[model samples]
Target: MNQNRVQASEVAPRAGLADISILANASLTSVTGTDMTSNAQGNYDLALKYSGTGLASVGVADKKVLVYALPAELQGKVVGGATVDIDANLLPITPGDIPGVKVLFDALGVTINTLNAVLPIPSVVAAFNQLKTVQNLGAYQKTLPAVVSADGKTISVEFTQELSEYVHQAYVATFGSLRAAIDALQGGNVVTKPLIDGLKLAADKLFDVIELIASGGSDILDLALNGNILGDMNGTLHTTVSDPGAASATVKAGAINNALISADVLTAIEQEGEAVTLNFPTTAVNPIENYDVAAPVITQPVAGQTQVAGQVTLTQPIPDRTTFEAVVTLPDGSTKNVPLAADGTFVVDTGSLVDGQTISAKVVATNGTYTKDSPITTATVTAAPIENPIADYNVATPSVAPLTAGDPEITGQVTLNQPIPLGTTFEAVATLPDGSQLTGTVESDGTFKSAGVDQLAAGQTVTNG
Candidate 1:
């Protein structure tokens, strides 16, 4: 042994294919050898011969083996299974095989036509095509983890920071105008020109626009924008009275004097003290006729009078004697009580008024328990005219002849100291004993005869006519 012993290193280094061990009693018949090649597709074939009839297993039985053409750093690391070649089958790497690599690729592959089938929206398809051209798309894809279902029908994508950032940017770009509009609305910085023009248009066709919106649906916008705002302008719409400081009944009368409302419409509302109630009519028509607040008609104090006669008369009777009083104001500014008669005649004797002095009078009516006053009517007064009397006139007594049975006529003669004027006409009036009156006309000579005396009785007496 010491003479020719071979070292194990030397023998091991020189060992060839023939020196390789095989199962016991199993022998190699022949091997088709090929030249060693550096190409990945290089192959070698071996033939085996066995003398024994028993079967022999090749490689490890009932064991899964994985072979990966990995880099030098990951040579021993557990990777994809050799049972199914990942590259040959085009299967994606899973997190189970590689702790960090989560990939799911469809066997059919994803294409633009496939995405177009899923998303029919043209804008979405265009956006997807644009996304594929982005320079950072690969970086984003690397951060996204996908999972394939066991059934191989679905691919679920897990949320990732890169995906989140991409989604946020997409949302902002898509809704940029909407976000700006909302901000403008919140800040009350809307464009005034367009708003005003739109408002004017709506005002012009308010009913039509309301009808259109109402036909849409029954939501809050329908009710607030159309139903509540566009209905009839009746009831409390045009006229609503509220008293914040006091009770509703304590509001002052005439405080709501809208010119559109007539006095008759408000007459029933008490204008006086507390507890005054307003009773509006169901209809808007004014019920009272000739409703007015005109001055009272004064009928006395005749025009163009030389004397100051303190008398006043109204065409119509006073409404209430208890609440009204007539007064005559003298030129000296003194007032006299002018008692009103039931017939509306009033007399105020400012005894012996001075010549050419003017007199004025007014009737004042008061509201019961309320200090309010009706319109006062002032009477027009004028001075009474001066007069002259005739100095002398003759009076003649006429004698009458008694009526006889045969002579039914009663004759009488009247004498004046002066001759009557040529154009003057005379008349005589007589009173009979029966309290009846008889009339006769005198001739130019002043003598007159009564012919209707035929009805005179015996006890009846006749006087000068």
Candidate 2:
């Protein structure tokens, strides 16, 4: 009842035929007497009675046939009317215990003999080894579990889904190597049509025997295993290949035509259902054409001169300006693109640059593949002018006055020696006899009015500051 351990009941109820017909090419008429019995080891033995004209014609000494092994889940339990389900999960025949496997393999060897006529192919020898690996059931038994009797008449078949896949891969590997060998021989023009055609038929026959064993003696080969088994190679083989003729080209200024790069085309040849590309040699062609582009000339913001108001204006006439754009480098070492006007002139605003700082400009032109830069044109940044408004203004002395309680204010006048800034103003301070000072204001009309001076005495002079 344990799932991992297969039971005798599981084996007996499922597959009842111990010896099944694996030689599908040989016609089988009937298989009867499915009296199956099992041991404690969960091994099932079936004494089947088989009747077939083709089976009798083989004259194989061993009468026992290959049989399918039940999967773990379908071992014991029987489902009524679900034969398809059982058939689908059944494993392939036990390769090691098949009665006439050697006989079947010998028959396949006969087919291989025709291919051996063209013997020097190393790949073909490799394919022969691969085919032999498929034939040696003992090699497969190393991985596939089997219980063979001492006399080799009874075999407890234990196979899984992997058997089908392993057999398929083996046969595919054989044909692939065989095809490679054939193509190599064909390329040398040594292999002929009759030889290749005979080899193809022989390959198919060998595949038929392997597939029958993989399918547990069934005539139906799985469609999954039938895909491009022979590499889909068909049609008449082409032995001789035509030589590819010479290639040609033309050169022009600044460009070369791409169509003339290759002088000849190497025709592809088909061998063993695959296309073989031939290597054809040709003379080398240089496609580069020699040429040169003239440098653009810079005309304005003359080199080594002060730029007006920190603005560097670069100018070029249409005839002299052939570049796409002009770049200006500022005193701070920053560069920016200067958009050229329709008249080919551009202005760079260096904005309030310090004294002795410089700005430079150059034209960049490209003719698709090559770029050229004209000689850099540079100019100095202009400095700001100094202002001295105080030096232009002058003030006159104030009037002497005797201090009286009733009238104590003094008046004064100021003069402008030259034009000064519009917002300029002047102030006056007077020291009386008491050592105290009186402060006064000056107007735009050059008039000065002082604060009250009630402490001033006779002969005390008031000085203007």
Candidate 3:
């Protein structure tokens, strides 16, 4: 194979990525093939190598490493009896030989074939610029020059592993710019409230993804850089469109238009040094206006409360168009709904809740446009403490004189085994010989007094138990 010959293909349209209107495609060039003599297995191998000389020329920094190949030419050999495999290698440059190119490969295994297939040089350059400008990575930029290999003569052909950090940093910086732009727009109240909220939420999630990548290290970086994140997000969003046929197309078109409009609004804001309005058309078919609404926040009940019932009064009364319901989940796995009053107060049922059991509650708010559910709040059931009854307590016998002849009153002093409780009361009783009984109150000092009794009743006795 000729080392200097680089093949190219006709430009093709980029589907699903209509927003990126950059260099769509490159022109095609003829592949000057070497003698393809088939081996015993009827397979042919093509190998191409690029030296460091051409890359050492003046204005080499501006030269792109990307190349496009037509699929027809690749299929021509496969259509024949022979199988074809093409391999290319880009040798590294010495760091000392180049002035502007500080490190040839940055020890990052970026080959020319990888640049041509996976990533173009223009995107890498653009991402680097964003990292510098948005994240203030001047120190990081300085460290880029020190990542070269010891000899800088050979590089691994895989680009994803090498450019993972580069792409992740670029994603972070780009997300930051987008967040800042959205903040500016929201602060100015330029976009509709729902749209602003939706964009902010999406940006926040993207930020979380970036943070996750930072913590997960290289494997996550490779996955995200290979478009898994975007692809997953696209699949998730496609499920939410009401009309899958025509509405999907309209929604995508509206999204592209809105993105373009947002960019223009951001530019205007930067130029005028002030807030600016963003105007984008909204129709029934293009439901960008119906973004997600934030969930309501509910207060928790007092700890150890036996019942989970409470009156939830919202700060602002819910609008007539909106409806609110409190979903109460019992320990038995059954659910109950509590409707909200016009005044935005909901009194949930607590009869089903029992002591030591837990019940979960969440609020669901819905309008015709959007529905949201609050985070679940749980409360453990508890009951008021019961006082222990007077059990296993001893009492001394009452001391009373034998019945005298005169009508003398009954009197006695009784002792208790345990200390008297604050609300404890004592009573004295006398059983007469006629099978009747008389009772009296006892003072805190353990002294008792009864009604007058005849002294003639000699067999009568008085006791305190």
Top candidate (lDDT):
2
lDDT by residue (234-272, candidate 3, tens digit) is: 000100001112111101111111222233432332232
CA lDDT, every model vs. true structure: 0.32, 0.38, 0.37
Q: Extract clashing residue pairs from model 3.
A: 404-455, 405-455
TM-score, ranked from best to worst:
3, 2, 1
Model 2 spans with C-alpha error above 4 angstroms: 1-326, 329-346, 349-407, 416-420, 433-436, 452-454
lDDT of 1: 0.32
Query: What shift in Å separates residue 75 of candidate 1 from its native position after superposition?
Result: 99
lDDT of 2 by residue, 1-465 (tens): 576466654664321111232222221111211222222212222221111122222111212222222222223322111110011111222221233334544543554465566544456666555645534211222222333333322223322344344444443343455455544555223454556565556556655665564555642334332321111101111111111222211100000111111111001000011111222225321111121222333333333443322222333222121335678787778887764565445665655557667667776654334455656777665445566765555645544444454447777675744566567767778777677888888767767778776845566666777
lDDT of 2: 0.38
If scored against the real structure, what TM-score would every candidate get?
A: 0.20, 0.23, 0.25
lDDT of 3 at 459: 51
Q: Could you tell me the TM-score of candidate 2?
A: 0.23
lDDT of 1 by residue, 1-465 (tens): 653465543453432212221112322121221111111111111111111111122111111111111112212221111111111000111111111110111111133234335433244334333322322111112222233223322122222223223322332243233223222321212534444333333323422332332343222221221111111100000111111111111111111112222233233222221121222223222211222223335444544432333223442322221344566666677987644565555655555545455566566544333222235555545445544232244557887765665555667888855655444566777776677666788877888876665566666666665
TM-score quality measure for candidate 3: 0.25
Q: Return the number of clashes found in candidate 1.
A: 7
